[model samples]
Target chain A: MHEMALAEELLKISDEAAASAGAEEVLRVGVGVGWLLQVERQSLAFYLEALRRDYPRLEHAVFELDEEAVRVRCRVCGEETEQAGWGFACGACGDRDVEVVAGDRLEVRDMEVRTDDV
Target chain B: MCETQGEGHQHRHLEVHRHAMEANDQVAARLRRGFAARGILVLNLISAPGSGKTALLERTLEQLRPLRVSVLVGDVETERDAERLRRCGVPVAQIVTAGTCHLEAGMVESHLAEVDQRELDVLIVENVGNLVCPSGFDLGEDLKVVLVSTTEGEDKPLKYPAIFHRAELALLTKADLAPHLDFDREELLRNIQAVHPGMKVLEVSAKTGLGLDLWLDWIRAKVGEKQSLHV
Candidate 1:
């Protein structure tokens, strides 16, 4: 699955960040998956854990993933709201002329790590 | 017992952006800049396995005369699609992912040598026959077009919104077989709008040469837009 690729990227990116920050051990990682893209959280979590052992600094790392909900701005009604999980339409008006203002982002948000000294 | 929260072992938290797509996105952006600077219009074509992407591409290559077009196609294995496209008398390259589901930007970047950007007006990438994974990754194309065959159900757009949402245009292929089948054209258009409102759709059949002129015009317009930017 593509989750494997995403997980590998997370480790590589996190490892680089950890190394640059002089982190001795990566304690936690944060990843944000967009709802529109449809990346499964459990599958991503599994791969992140499965691949952590490869990166020495991330051997003890735990991942925290957040799903960014899709938000749309309606053109006809000028209403903005979160999509109701499936087929998208204006929540206020029944118009389909809406623009996606948020969501569809697949990214690593922030991470926490342990350094060599306090 | 330890005196503190690990007495001498220090801890720190950093708000960093090591996104899952950071590396890929960076590569894609660079590729996009290169293509734009060279005055090239790159279109990434994505669809299901039997959606006739190669057939449509063959028709396009044949009809887009004097356009100086090149192609880069991807599949899990084999150079078959590349061979089929080569018959159209244009430069073509086949990228074998060796079991990967989709093509990444780095994979495409490595194949840049296959085509001479200086002599090319447009570059078409035939993505691996998949709807989901390919839509998730970006390859720095100016536009992403999804092809849907008439044999498939009309709800394809609603079923796979990721790619539909990513695409600015939709191609309903195999229009010649429409009368023989029970497919509702209006329903399909409605479904496409449900996911992507106001998306330009063209009903084309590569086999029967239906609506090829309209499709070609769309391509010409896109290429012209890019060339104008360079001037």
Candidate 2:
């Protein structure tokens, strides 16, 4: 649902970053999505691919997603564990009071740009 | 084709950081800072459409009429909720998101400017009734209060754990109907606990005023805490 908006932002960033770097064309964009965000990767890719058609420089550019797992640290045992979906219980100590340490990140990590200059 | 030693048509990977929700989160952070400066405590209320959010707000507003309080109601369509809150004799703003399911931080920040800061002690944002999308968004509120009624079943916490997990307070609304319905009170609390350990839970009935005092006291305490920080 909100993936369309996110995809739009991703394309805008790619175009701006490419232009600023003196690149004639964008090759690829790397996007990082944490497990916490409920983004459909397929839908995001579809939207990015479909929307990039409007940008000439991004015609061949593709957006790639690298999703990170949700990680939490148990408050009682101080053990960090990867959470599966909504489960936050610590595997070792079985403590429910786990604090989320990682995940929930949705950002553009890097982009590959090609310049026409020789 | 001769390639220069330092310069040529080469592929380069540049670190371009563009946060997906950076736009929204930035605005929310700004709003948080602004509220902190003004010594105002903001609360974002999220729940299903019929989870008694409006009812609880109405009751809370009426009881807190002596104090300065305002509300911003978010809906897909209609000024109905805003109009109802106006009867409480407090500043009320209606944010119609058209077809948008959730209210973003930009929306809250823009509408908040319309509110009179001098007369407002606390701001309560009633998010568009949904359990999923709103959980991911930060609306510059001091607390994210999630409401779930007994009729919705205890499994709601398990079904939509994200909302409960992110919420600072989980409110069980419509306790007046608990007698007529076979709503497992203990199970619901347990489910909420499982999702978010140490999260605060309160049972409030707008009709019966059950736990209204405690809710108001909590708000007062929050307001006092905010004001104390300013001092």
Candidate 3:
């Protein structure tokens, strides 16, 4: 439900970046989704495709998704490891006091654009 | 044809590096600044449905009767919670999210405009009962309070670690029922500590008024802290 809104934001940002760069069209946009955000990638992609139809400049654009991993540091053993799921227990010492390091970011990493000089 | 077309057009890779939630975060930051300037302490309460959030708040409001406090209730669709809070004699506003599972900063910012910020010491935003989506969205509150009940089992903090990790304080509601149920206190506390090592936990039974004083005192301390900063 909210993914559509998020997807719209991504497109708006991409469009603005493209326009500022004097690009004729966006070729591809890279998005990084954090594990904690729980955004549905497929739904976001679908919405991106449907909304792009309204913009001729984005008709040829592709939305790429990159899922980030949850990394944590154990408070007991001081071990840092990537969590496979929501379990925050340390893999080595089985300590529950593991601090989350990353994977809580949602950002547009980069974009490829084509200039009007064609 | 590919080589000819590639030679004719200029393709460039641009670094756009922007947060996807930038729009919401910006509004949330603005609201935080606005609250600080007004010396208002805002708290966003989040929990799973039936985790006793509204009930706890109702009791809390009654316990802190003399305090100037207001509430903003968020629900999928209902004025029931708002009406219930109104009985406590505080100005309450109901924000119907329509179908959204969580309350975003924009919603809070808009509803906040209707309330006179200068008149209140505390503004409580009861988020739409959800642990997942609400944890990811910042509502510009000074603190995020997560509630879990004894009946929900001790593993709840482990099951929904995201909410636990994001919360500054975890309130173990329905503490009166702990004796009747097989709720493992040590296990639950350990789980919460695991997710947030330094997160503060409070046990209170809104029904029995047990531990209610501590809760009220905490609120007062926080309010005083916020006021002193502006002074």
DockQ of each: 0.64, 0.61, 0.53
Proportion of native contacts kept per candidate? 0.76, 0.66, 0.71
Off by over 4 Å in 2: A73-80, A85-98, B1-9
Summed over model 1, clashes come to 1
For residues B94-185, what per-residue lDDT tens digits would candidate 2 score against the true structure? 99999888899999987987789777789999999999878888888999999999899989988888788888888899988999998899
Model 3 residue B49 CA deviation in Å: 1.3
Docking class for candidate 2: medium
TM-score each candidate.
0.91, 0.90, 0.86
Enumerate residue pairs that collide in model 1.
A108-B19
Off by over 4 Å in 3: A40-43, A46-56, A70-102, B1-8
Q: How well is candidate 3 docked (DockQ)?
A: 0.53
Candidate 1 chain A has its poorest 10 consecutive residues by lDDT at A109-118
Q: Supply the global lDDT for candidate 3.
A: 0.85
Considering the two chains of model 1, state its CAPRI-style docking category.
medium
User: What lDDT score belongs to each candidate, Candidate 1 first?
Assistant: 0.89, 0.86, 0.85
Q: What is the C-alpha RMSD of each candidate to the true structure, in Å?
A: 3.0, 3.2, 3.8
Error of 1 at B119 (Å): 1.0
**CA lDDT of B102 in candidate 1?**
91
